[model samples]
Target: MFEIKDNHLAAGDLLAEALAKVPGIRHVKEVNDLSDIDKPTATPCLFYLYYGDQLTDAANAGANMQLKQTWLVVLAERKGSKQAGTNITATIRAIAGKMTGGAGPWQRVNTPIKPKYTNGHAFYPLAFTCQMRFKGALK
Candidate 1:
């Protein structure tokens, strides 16, 4: 018998666990949108936003299917502090060092974009990609 697993959720769980270990990470969670987060008790919060997923390959009859899922790791910090920029940069490097180029489910996609400032908050968006396989139907 074959079973289909919730790989997306699994990936998110793995991400949360890994991100929790990075120093200076105050909060980590999966959010539908970046605006969903209000004022956190701590700075340098990390949010996981599911971007999208696509079928990587067409599955023949009884063959497994492959999917590529993309996610965004947004690092948010309150602006105005002198160490704001340095803190963001250090946290970004820590996250990259811990999450990238490992046997993890996700891989860093590209360079993080410039910070976006809004309402005294600065957000740095980093992209990541993951591959998952769905088992074929049982005969």
Candidate 2:
């Protein structure tokens, strides 16, 4: 499939099962054991997610194009939760190499929707941002 589940929304059981399959265009997995923070009047909650990274640089960079592998960092956080919850993020280093002098060896990274807690599903009010630099661009 072109799109997969996000980390926050993935159920434990579903995550386990998906992991066993050969990743097609996308893959999803939830992570736990992360840090947590307690709210003033809310139950203490932990941060987690189902994450996947794919490389589409080959197609993006044609035979004449140069590929420069570089580390890329992705940060995801809840919009607002008393600002008490710890930010949960996943790092998929060197996802897409640089596109030489061109713009980039473009690619897309997707995170599953947060699960709902009531029906054993939880909502992850999260936002994501990315940072990347080409191989030789940095000093």
Candidate 3:
């Protein structure tokens, strides 16, 4: 068995900081912070990240020592529904660009699907996933 200790916290922090640069964004929160909020505020905009999973490749012996970690990113803009999709999609694209250009700490292993608007929500919400590879010691 192998244990992979990926820098998920650090990665999420960096990603959030990057997103905070988007204009009108009042909230750059983590899932942990969301959990503590009894009543969420109608902030101008908000984004949060949740840790996903770490899975290793069992087929390859070498791959067993490493794992792929994923994060679920949620974006919401309460000000304008029409502009919500555009805002979230642009932010996602910016994150992707950072990965390809080596602007971030971890390698972005996967690309998020195009962001779309959702119904039945007070804010225009979009969800996406980000993946990163993590190496660990083999035993």
Question: Which candidate wins on TM-score?
Answer: 1
Q: In terms of TM-score, which candidate is stronger, 2 or 3?
A: 3
Looking at model 2, report the run of 10 residues with the lowest lDDT sum: 33-42
- Top model number, lDDT: 1
lDDT assessment of candidate 2? 0.28
Error of 2 at 34 (Å): 12
Could you give candidate 3's per-residue lDDT for residues 1-59 as a string of tens digits? 11225544555666676777776566666776433422346544565655455554543
Residue-level lDDT tens digits of model 1 in 1-139 = 1123754456666666767766777778789876775555567788887777667774667377777667787777886656666655654555442433232445567734556777777777788766766676657
Error in Å for residue 55 of model 2: 1.5
Candidate 2 C-alpha lDDT tens digits along 64-129: 222322221212223344422332222222222222123233233333343333322223433222
Pairs that collide in candidate 1 are none
Error of 2 at 127 (Å): 5.8
Residue 30 displacement in candidate 1 (angstroms): 1.8
Model 2 stretches with alpha carbons more than 4 Å out = 1-46, 58-111, 119-122, 125-139
What TM-score, over all chains together, does every model reach? 0.72, 0.23, 0.57
lDDT of each: 0.65, 0.28, 0.50
